[model samples]
Target: MEYSMLADIDTGEQSSQFLTFIMADEEYGVEILDVQEIRGWEPCTEIPNMPQYVKGGINLRGTIVPIVDLRQKFGFNNIKYITTTVVIVVKVLVEDKSKTMGLVVDAVSDVHTIAHSDINLPPQLGLDTGPRVIRGLVSIRDKMVVLLSSSLLLDLNQFQNIEQINEHKTQQPMATND
Candidate 1:
């Protein structure tokens, strides 16, 4: 399921839906179907021996999910969090299977419907955040929002580790009352 952002845009209902979010001062969007829910920033239990981009896992609705700091993943200068900090839960498909993961962003923005015509290949000009991850751009309230590919936002190896952890937990036997 992990795919680098590409330029092609297909038509139909699947073409326009997106969930917008902010990181630092820039705006970005991911397909709405990929998003699970928006949550306020919560303390994450640090996991030893994991990538720095992996901010660790947090208990979400009684389920543990790994959180990733998009700011760091995009190579932006760190900034202090305010009340606006939020975690976006996205369902990512890996090896043809779906899995949930958390993305930390500065804030959540309005959802937008970007038509196929509005999407274009990212400019050849180099960008600080790396142009490879940008699928296209759309104008939102006089501000340009970069549309991102859901697959590129995550790392496959890390996701696999999350799946393994979940599997291990499930395999453990429960205590008997008797």
Candidate 2:
């Protein structure tokens, strides 16, 4: 879906498209505008001293794109990557500029058109003042889809030294055959 699908002419409501995916049986979406591309699971050049969630980095043409597994990042049980596993390349706002990263998800579900009004603010669990990863929630097809604020999902500072990480690389095995 394109950003051109942002407005409904008849109703005059502002809406945006979301690229939805499934993880641990739950639906999650990232704004379509942030999506750069989707790719199949492939081994990446592993970096030393990075968090478990930071899978590694891949050479996208000439750019070294860091990959992150959402399941691991969100504290879900680790599972072997299969055919359904894919990497969604997205441009996230880091600091003031945009940075490209790959998010490893279970599988892509669909492209949903949701209106701005339909999105509900995420509840505050406690008095924690930490940055929020969830942007909002929306009901689509009678199921709740967690819309993620891509910009806040990853720790911006962790990737600031990407060039250094690229300097040290080894292939990491992430996929398996069952």
Candidate 3:
């Protein structure tokens, strides 16, 4: 289902709307409704025996939220601190319920109002990353921002695994509690 938004663009009678951000020199966007908040990078509690792309979890207002590093997910070389680093907290529907997750990006560019007509489907060829996550492409000031599907971006399989692990942990009799 394609959700459309209003934008203020030079194109007369047609406008573009998008929430744009930067990751590894490329701009990307997600529907505004899917976004919950933009937060500065914070230390995350590491989860053992998980994928490298999964950068552990963060405490958001007393709730534990998992974070994903787009750079690692997209096969970019790991680098030390960069000033542009930020975490975008997105609310995604998982298993019929809304769940919040943090996406680590290089930086946030701007929230653009992208017209529906301005978006172009990404080419099937030569895409290093699989196209399953990317919905389409849109131009913003000579740069193309890949529009990402929040549902696909926040696949809950890993989280489900984490939940299983936690369930086992809880099932085990706690030395202190017992």
Leading candidate by lDDT? 2
Give all TM-scores, in the order shown: 0.82, 0.87, 0.79
> Candidate 3's residue-wise lDDT over 49-158, tens digit each?
67898898876785567888988987887766467688889887778877778889888888777666777987888656642888798877887789988777746777
lDDT of 2 by residue, 1-178 (tens): 4343489788999998999999998999999999999999999988677798999889987678889999999899999999999999999878777888999999999999999999999997786746888989999989999999888877866677685555554445657999
lDDT of 2: 0.89
Off by over 4 Å in 2: 1-5, 127-129, 165-178
Better of 1 and 3 by TM-score: 1
Residue pairs with backbone atoms closer than 3 Å in model 2 (clashes): none
Q: Could you say which candidate leads in TM-score?
A: 2
**Candidate 2 local lDDT, residue 96:** 75
Better of 1 and 3 by lDDT: 1
Candidate order (lDDT): 2, 1, 3
Q: Which scores greater on TM-score, model 1 or model 2?
A: 2
Off by over 4 Å in 3: 1-16, 126-131, 164-178
Candidate 1 local lDDT, residue 26: 87
**Inter-residue clash pairs, candidate 3:** 15-115, 16-113, 16-114, 16-115, 17-113, 17-114, 17-115, 18-112, 18-114
